[model samples]
Target: MSAVTAPTKGTPAHRRSRARGPLLSKRLRMAGLYLAGAAVFLFSVFPVYWMVATAFKPVSEIFSGTPSLLPGTPTLEHFDRVINGELIPGVSFWRFFANSLTVTLASVLMGAVLSLLAAIAVARFRFRLRTAFIMVLLVIQMVPMEAMIISIFINFRQLQDATGVQMLGNLTGILIVYTAVSLPITIMMLRGFVAAVPKELEEAAAIDGAGNWTIFWRILMPLVAPGLVAASIFAFITAWNEFIVALTFLGRSTDYYTLPLTLSYYFGRYGTEWGSIMAASTLLTIPVMIFFLFVQRRMVSGLTMGAVKG
Candidate 1:
């Protein structure tokens, strides 16, 4: 009979084919990519990790000759010192915290309001010197704060003299400085966002009898909310972490200290308290992280806005 087609025995060579090797090669390439990314992440994150690790270490362990990737025994003592007002003998952390909160919040809020309004005008309306005004802002931004510090200090001092106010060492003074410094960039940035929203929509609103303010509030603001969020985060971070101006203006007033200035308490003529300093540094980073988390969604959306070409 058909001597049978007993299952074709042509198979030994075919069975041994090296198909899996190519799949394994692809897996190896994927693994290599994963390793490379992990290396970069670890490299970037290590210093921040070390700072927090060092912060939690005991004073004795911190100064020990051997370096450590992880502290042997983490202690809350240093943070307790900061909380208890013993980190710096005379500085009041709560008072400084309050000052920072008030100044940062006020400056960010006022800047957002003023800058958004200016951005709408610049983006939607044509006026004299409009281009020149934008160019002037760019040039002013190019000038380093160090160069302007003296002039700003003098100007604020004059304001204090004229108003009989402590413009050089108070919340009002710091807020004004932050607002002015942050406004130019904020306005420029929001201008693009305002420009992105179609003018036709605004005209439609106007035709429908909506007033300028109503159209802005109902139609425009929500459309550019992402940009507003991004700008607020930028302004908040800039003002919150500013050390030079704060040091220059708020130096004499410990009560006016922001978190960054609070770290100066750890410095001593004899030797710096590295442990407490690290702890303070760790604490200083927390607010920034929180602020970023709060704005992260809007940041992503704002970044995505550039994808809209028209």
Candidate 2:
């Protein structure tokens, strides 16, 4: 029989080295991942930081050759101009803000209600052309707004000619457009949320003598609230930041211009008012941030929960 050699001291050390190799590799990988994440964070946030910083910088500092990261002497003159100064000839800042708020809120509300109802119909009922309808929604989303802008404008003009009610140069036209534009995606998103809900819950509610409306309000709405919040955010952002549509549809109707339209006034024939532009941009970003912060929790939960199959 062959004699078994006793395990040597180096044998254990060899095993330890092998073990440490993977551990060390894992640690290095983790470190690399953290570094990559930090780089991405800085890249994403730098522009926002610069915009906010520039908004506070005085005109002299804003135009300085050596740009500073932080304003040496932070001033609110730019904000003052944006808030108090009439950027437009007769229109005040609040008018543009109110217009934006109206359009965005109206679009968001209408989109949410319509999307939720449509989602329920699609997800709960087995209707004819259901698959085709879903495919059409996806197709609509794939089409770029720029490609369709001309056709949309012509359609609105034709509608105005036909109905004798102005579709162009008014908030009503843009409100309808914003709501319509947001519908396809919001419907698709809410469809998943609605479908993911167990049908048994609705059945149980019915057994408990809950009517269709009661079941929807009590059982369905709470479960789907997160999705609605998520969809609303999408609609809100789309309407709020929309420039081309607002520019085209409003069409020299300066009285009905949105906040995005106000940014153009800072770009004069000769030079740009960088301070005012940045200040306006900073202000533009605040509402979005506030809205996001308010709904971030539900948004996060909705995104994750909607992915799961019931």
Candidate 3:
């Protein structure tokens, strides 16, 4: 051209077009990511949502040909049915709840303490068969509990026959089993956590006039508390939801039944009581949720504090 044209305040057309292309692509990519995340969330949560919704739905609605996403007329009859001993006569739902609570708490407490001590010893000290011990733990963890159920039952029965300790038809048997089963994994997890901690910290405490007991309790314990918390949660959940062992040991006694065992009564020869089953299932899940909520902050923050700040 004879005369050159000045670039406009809005910028040249090529530059504007180039910027628009990247901006549009970025927005599309962001939108796709959001969509994928939402879809995944919905897929994962649908079953849980359905269970909760079904708990409130009446018998007629639950048995309807077409299912509704929400209850049209929510009712507490199913809850009442479960709580009033209708599901299994002469057995209050609270009894099963209490059984689960006692067993789970005892198992978790004992497991955590024993696991922490063992983990500390393994991670810090050199001893005979140390590598073999760690390998044994790994091997035990690899063996599924189902595979050992028969042997476990036979041994418990034999012990009961010999010692008359009431291994079967009692909570103690399963408590022992759960603690033993959970131990290997808990020890392994805590071992890593203990190893991550610098031995220099303990030495520093010693230099500052700290005794072995004092250094162990005051310094080492706090540093590994996060691992302890994690292992406890695992043990708690294990003992809480254990079914086959509870079923095998508790026998036919409703008094010794756990929450999972109680839910089995909801299915009859005629038809399943979906509403009551859902209600009971919902109640069963509440304690786990409550426990998690109580310790979640500690669980998340403890890791950072123990590793970084300690």
Best by lDDT: 2
lDDT of candidate 3 over 72-144, digit per residue (tens): 9999998998887555677788888888898898989999888988998898899998899989988997798
lDDT of 2 by residue, 1-310 (tens): 0111235433553455446768677557557867999999999999999999999999999889999899999999989998998778788899999999999999899889999999988998998988898889879877988999999999999999999999899898899989999898888879878987998999999999999889989999999998888889978987999988888898788899899877764455214788888898998999989888766765554446456544
lDDT of 2: 0.85
| Shift in Å, residue 53, candidate 2 | 0.3
Worst 10 residues of 2 by lDDT: 1-10
Off by over 4 Å in 1: 1-29, 203-209, 268-271, 294-310
Q: Residue 244 in candidate 1 has what lDDT?
A: 83
lDDT of 1 by residue, 255-286 (tens): 77777777764554214667777777888788
Q: Each candidate: RMSD to true structure?
A: 9.6, 8.1, 8.6
TM-score result, candidate 3: 0.83
What are the clashing pairs of model 3?
Answer: none
Given candidate 2, what's the lDDT at residue 277?
Answer: 86
If scored against the real structure, what TM-score would every candidate get?
Answer: 0.82, 0.84, 0.83
Note the residue pairs that clash in candidate 2. none
